[model samples]
Target: MIVQHNIMALNSYNRLGTNNNAVQKNLEKLSSGYRINRAGDDAAGLAISEKMRAQITGLERAQLNAKDGISLVQTAEGALTEVHSMLNRLVELGVESANGIYQATDRDKIQAEVNQITEEIDRISKSTNFNGIKLLDGSLGSSTANVDGGSAITATQTDATQAQYVGANAVLNGVTFASLTKGDVLTVTVNTRINGTDSAQTFSLTYNPDKHTQLSDLQDALNAQIKEAFGADFKVTDNTQVLTFEAKEAGADKAIVSGMSWTVKNYNDSASGVVVATGSTSMTETKGVDAYTTVSGFDGGATALTKTSSSADVEKNTLTINGQKFVMVKDKDAAANVNKIDSGINVIVAKDLDQAAADIEKATGIKVAVDGNNLKVFAPKGAASGGAGLTLQVGDTADSFNKVTVSVDNMSSAGLGVNGLTVTDQGIAADSITRVKSAIEKVSVNRGRLGALQNRLEHTLNNLATTTENMTNAESRIRDTDMAQEMMAFTKNNVLVQAAQSMLAQANQQPQQVLQLLR
Candidate 1:
């Protein structure tokens, strides 16, 4: 045996080192409670676990985002509840005023209350917020169609006209009353000016052929009835087989006749009445339009022109912009009609093209200017700030349905259709009633939408939680060490290390044996 070259000892020494290294590795796995403590231990497993960790973190954050979304929906819905209540109150007032029992003074008091409610509604819409973000100002998602800007339009009232006629008076007007028998009832509605505002009153007359066979008797009966009911002097005159009713006073403020209607009821056969000539008239009070200019470098710009007396001619006008259509209708408080587009854009009717351009700018963030009888609309310069609509990201992934967009519209009195409600007379009050009801419906719809979104977010949160739990479990399987199994491995490695040490000592002794032989 050569002292310098001891092959057996060398082999045993290498085995000892190998076993010692394995023992340390097993110790690490047990102490750390992870199958792969480092990349050197399991490179592929580390990569996979890290990916799972990222997904888990993302899911956690997404859940938080969903919670925030629910909070926002709740905030908006709460404000809308108040709006709903106000609309109900407005409807109540409207119905009361339409009964014609209240005088002009009483109606005015009711109108004041309505106006206050409207203003409050507008205030709530403008101020309602979640985390300082306006909720009901149509910033979420908005669409628009053909619409342009114009001056502020005022309210207009239609001219008075004779709507119906009955009795022997009908015969004088070349129409025969075939069923003017006993117990026949005739209803007459008179629209007149009272206290500088429009008012209406109705009178019912029961026909008794035995008591009212002569035309003179019929005229006297009608005169006495009119004087008592309306507190006004009026005479019905006949000229060449034609009948005309005129107020005794003569002047603009002399309770001029606005409209007249008559209806026959409780007749054996069909009652006959003739409608006199229809009257069409309107009065406008102008509020100047605000102007708007276009931002440079805007594509898809549009031009709008304002038309005079002819401008208010259209009962309803439609505008198509960016594949969206906006319908414009006359507003009592505006000089021209206005349209609220689904895209959060507003179209204002103006007296002229310049006024339209101005009004458009004031209403929409978009800028516009008159381009020869046409108003041009353009996007504002720089990124849309302040007025940019709401954007909600609901998922970690960039996919459809992961994002929700909503356009919260203005919820003010004007937006709710009660901005210019008037209760001066039965006709006007009746119109107000219809408008108030419509506002109530709008508020209901908005509330429903918000509630639905809240529910969807709740479901989203649950899904995220489940996904996180399952993924965490998968990650644990890949990364966590089974303590019992690791302990067994550690014990086996410990025994092998001791055995290798003992063998190492024996192998070193063999090298000493060579020295003994040399001695």
Candidate 2:
């Protein structure tokens, strides 16, 4: 009775449209098989999964990087192996040289080979590289130790006597002396002469002050004339009244006196026995008082004179700093012999003596030893005397270098000297090779650690894959529509739509009864 519009058909169409949309969504879910097809499907889950995906990818790549590091270390180790082989061969050559069987010529040939091997070492040090980074060359690394700190870094050379061979000059004055004059003879009348030793040579001298300007001046002139004549072989002595001349050289009998106005008494005698005027004096007592190399004579005993050599009055190497030369000692044991370094520097003591020694050598070209609580730095006896200037700095302390720490671990057994890879007849060369190998091993072990970390990453990746699968499945249950249930609903909705259309047609037909009333 209150039929205003076909509201039942309108309601049926609206319900069918809604059920169709649901069915279509279920079908899409079945086809795609993922809960989140886009950001609209699940916002928070998509964001978290994306982050996890990036981490998994980075971990995989990191593992590859670690593997590459291992390869580089292995390559360097292989090259070092070849160097070790060549070193062993050089050691064999050194042994052959030391046998004393080889002549000078054979040794020369061996030296040539040694030179070639040294060239090879230089070549390897320069040419070896990894990723454009040189590995065996000492130039590759920056010094971690700071030399400018408050601690003094020093180096010492070992041999003190090698300076003589290097043309070091002596402090020279104009004065010189003759070692001996041969003319005077005191006949041994009390001691009977042997069968063939009765011959002698004789000479005499009379000192006149009017003939020479001063006695001291005459003595200098006489000393120089004598030394120029006999070099270091002859000796002279004066007893204030008469001057005696003698020779210590075998079969030496005569001397010509120079720069003196004197007459000979008995110039002629048998030459079977000779006399020498060798004079001796205490050199230490005459230091700074008399000119060096002055000789005085005793009445009748063996006389000694200072043998003239460049070493007799040599000065120490002049070390200059800040435009001033530091006072140095010819011998390190003399009074106040230490070279006074003026600059203040911070000291970063290394963990052990060996490391400290190496640092000092690198910084100052001098080796150092830990003496009790102090450091004793010595130049290798004859190291050439030039060094990079040291700057006193206090800012940055070396964090990598440890301060004087002693542990009970075994020594590294590696060095560049007798025990190292430069193998003469000594095992030092082998020791250096061993140390290098050990270093290589340490790098290799570090690479192994990286490899282990890479393995862990791989395991994590696998776990992430399994977790991703499970999580995706769980999300699917929450967001996906079931294809079986949706298909049934779609089919039922289609049937209901057709049945509603039929019932609506029948209801509309009932409204056409006015035509039957007109008939």
RMSD, every candidate, angstroms: 24.0, 29.5
TM-score of 1: 0.55
lDDT string for model 1 (374-452, tens) is 3344322211111235666766677867776655554655445465466655665776687778778877877888888
The parts of candidate 2 lying over 4 Å away from their true place are 1-4, 94-96, 111-118, 121-519
Best by lDDT: 1
Clashes of 1: 34
